[model samples]
Target: MRIVSGGIQHETNTFSHQPTTLADFERDSGCGPDFSGGQAVFDRYRNTGTIHGGYIDAADVLEFDLIPLICAKAQPSGVVESTAFDTILNLFLDRLSETPAVDGVLLDLHGAMVTAACDDGEAPFMEAVRERVGPDIPIIATLDLHANITQRMADACDVIIGFDTYPHVDMRARGREAGELLVRMIRGEVQPVQAYRQLPLLTMPPMQCTLREPMQSLMQNVFRMEDEPGVLTATVAMGFPFADISAAGVSCLVTTNNDAALAEKKVEELAGWLWDLRDELQPQLTPIDEMIEFAATHDGPIVYADGSDNPGGGAPCDGTVVLRALIEAKFQNAVVGILHDPETAALAHQAGVGATIEARVGGKTDDRHGTPIELPAYVRALCDGHFVHHGPMNQGVVGEFGPMALLLVGGVEVVVSSNRKQLLDREMLRVIGVTPEHRRLIVVKSAVHFRADFGECATHILDADTPGIHRPDYANYDYQNLRRPIYPLDNVTVDFGG
Candidate 1:
């Protein structure tokens, strides 16, 4: 059987001021081993700085004729540039058309992309692909746990699987499930049916994690439903709240063959369950001052989610909201990563390790998020940050935190680097010679993904409304063209497909 697979991934934040440009994608995400490398590198591309990966190791395991098109995505941005989307789409199609008659299609998609000219970006792309492939062939897709699923997406694809974990440790596993489901459908072993729903409420805070309270229980029930006879898979897409598109809301999806109706019913039940507990899914947000006070009193390390500047969710990752707050409150024994400063990093490196230097770090690009934080810090260590992901998301993948240094700033040891890196794992800290466990408070510039690695060790975890590009509040977005009459945007109630 002939199979064609590729990916176009982006999660747009309509609220962001930056446009999703080709250059952004090229610099932040692109590098298929096909591009010319005169380029300044995404030094921390994977975990070890290697790019050209999209299939997530499932490709090698399945071992079919595979064509990997450019799958580049930056953190949430403003609307995607039309030129960028068209060029990538054309390349992907050109590649697809060259291949022989295909048996199946798989896509690595971020379900929250929006274009400057259009909203619901995934629908138009899928419709184009559907037009190309026709109805008989099956299309399977895997989404980020933060995917904002639309009805058009559900209608177009035969089976859509989403990441079960927020830190995206289950990314490859979901790909595996999609690939296996494709084989089953192609073999006529199982027919796929889907059920979906959008809740009235929108967004469960930036750090809403599947391993915690309501989301954890929700994921457990999703598994239980899958174990039932005739249920192929079940998913709980918490939805990307930053994308002001109409599809932004919590959703439940179920796919199966033998009992399609039963699958729909099961999904509806789960959707209702999620809706009932919508308000409860949120992490208890602690104000920075209160969080510090609490941390000072705690015996073990406390994990703080700097929800404002998460690079994984399309944030600048350089906002000094928490840093400023920490400095003001005179908080100590805290490790906050990272302030993306190429200049400051260079200065620190030149200053040599153990030298004291004053550097202006963080809050350079977008000051609306937070004030600039300057501190006299001692350069502790510098390294070409390298580590293999020991987690499920990109396990064994090498990454680099280029020209990185540990800066001891006002009793808070900070991880500063030239490149923007997601602090999803503990090693991100450990690579810079800082042990997060040894600190009283560990502030991570991440959304929900950090919970995967740090949740186990944290005595208490709190998400703060720190400032950045990706705000959790949906109404704060300045939407010009997103479909109206949707949740939070227009306050419309949606019924589960009953």
Candidate 2:
């Protein structure tokens, strides 16, 4: 049997001022810079731990011909430019139309993508694919745990499998599951019936982590439900709340073997179980001052997750609130990593290693995060900022932050980069001569993904309540398009009838 597969992935933050463009996708896809279409897709993902990697493995095991097409992804940022969105969509559709007698399609999607043209990006993209493939073709998609699932997306695809783990360690696993299920459907071994529901509740990244409570119990239940007789699969997309779309909230989906009743029942049960814990889903954060004070008195090896300025969630990684406070307090042997400051990084590279250079670092994006820090920084090291992730999440994937410079600003060692990236891996610091394990305090500009790598050695992990677009505080966001009566945003309950 023959199958065609590819997708465009991005997690858009409406609150961010920088609009994502096609140029960003060319440079920052999971497959590396300027990668798209055909054999390049297989070459990049064949042995990797990404969604497409799982697809490749499934193709080898299931013995189905997997035809790869255009799969492009840009860093999480503001809404995509309309021209870029249309260009990629048309390219994907055109390729699908050109394919010969394809039996199925597998999409590797992030599911939280928002463009200038549409708030519900995945729905329309799937609908377009459906239009090209006709009704008989089976389409299965693998999504991030944080998908803002829409009913239209459910209607367009045959099966939707989402990651059960945050830090998203299960990308390849979920992809393999989707592929195996698709093969079953193609062989008439199992007929898939799906049930889906959108919750009237939204949540933040810190609490949505499957490694932590509420989510851990919730995902365990989802797994148990999947083990039941005739249940094909189950997904609990915590949803990307940073999106200002109407579908920006928690959602549940269940697929059963030709059993719509069972699918609906399992989905309802999942949604209700999640809804019951709405109050517990809220995140607790440490004030920057309190975190700094604790670091002063405490021993070594503490990790402060700077989630508010997570570049992965579309916040500019240059937030200076925590860095500025640490500098003023003279925090020593501490490392703050992967700060997005191209100008400062360039200056450090030009000044050479061991040279003390006057550099203005971070907080250059906007006023909401914080003001830029002006200080005399010693250029300790310089690197090309290319590294492979050895962590549980996105392991074997290539990551680039352009050129990077390690600057010693007062007692704090700051790693600045030309590109914006979340500090999720230890290799991100290690490449620039800063060892994370040896540092007294390590601040990562990430929400939860960092835990997959950094949590293993760190003595303590604290979530810092800083200022930026991705902050867990719901009040920081001004929601003009979101559907109201959601949890925390309002005191409301949901009764999604099975």
- Model 1 residue-pair collision total: 8
Maximum-TM-score candidate: 2
Q: Which residue runs does candidate 1 get wrong by more than 4 Å?
A: 33-63, 258-260, 473-498
Q: The CA-based lDDT of model 1 is what?
A: 0.73
TM-score of each: 0.89, 0.98
Computed on alpha carbons, the lDDT of every model, listed in order, comes to 0.73, 0.90
Residue range 1-498, candidate 1, lDDT tens digits: 666666678888776777888776676553543322212122223232112233434445667544554556655667899988887777777777777788888877878888877777877777777778889999987777777788898898988888888667776567667777787788898888887766665665553576667677778887888898888988777777777666676776888786767976888888777766755754445677788888889875888888768777667778887887777777888888976777778889999998998888877767656756677889999988777776555665666667898888777877888877778888788888887788888888887778777877889888876656665654446665445655444556555544
* Clash pairs detected, candidate 1: 47-398, 47-399, 48-398, 48-399, 48-400, 49-399, 75-314, 76-314
For model 2, give the 10-residue run with minimal summed lDDT: 28-37
Candidate 2 residue-wise lDDT, 1-498, digit = tens: 998989989999999999999899887765545446778888878877889889989999989999988889988999999878888889888888888999999998889999888999888889999989999999998889999999999999999999999898888888888888899999999999999998899999999988889899888888899999999999999999899889999998999999999998889998889888898999999998899888888876899999999999999999998889899998899999889999999999899999999888888889988998998999999999989889888889888888999999778999999988899989999989998999999999999999999989888899988988999999998999999878888988557553
Q: Which whole-number lDDT from 0 to 100 does residue 201 have in model 2?
A: 91
Candidate 2 scores a C-alpha RMSD against the true structure in Å of: 1.3
Question: Relative to the unseen true structure, what is the Cα RMSD of model 1?
Answer: 3.8
Cα displacement (angstroms), candidate 2, residue 52, comes to 0.2
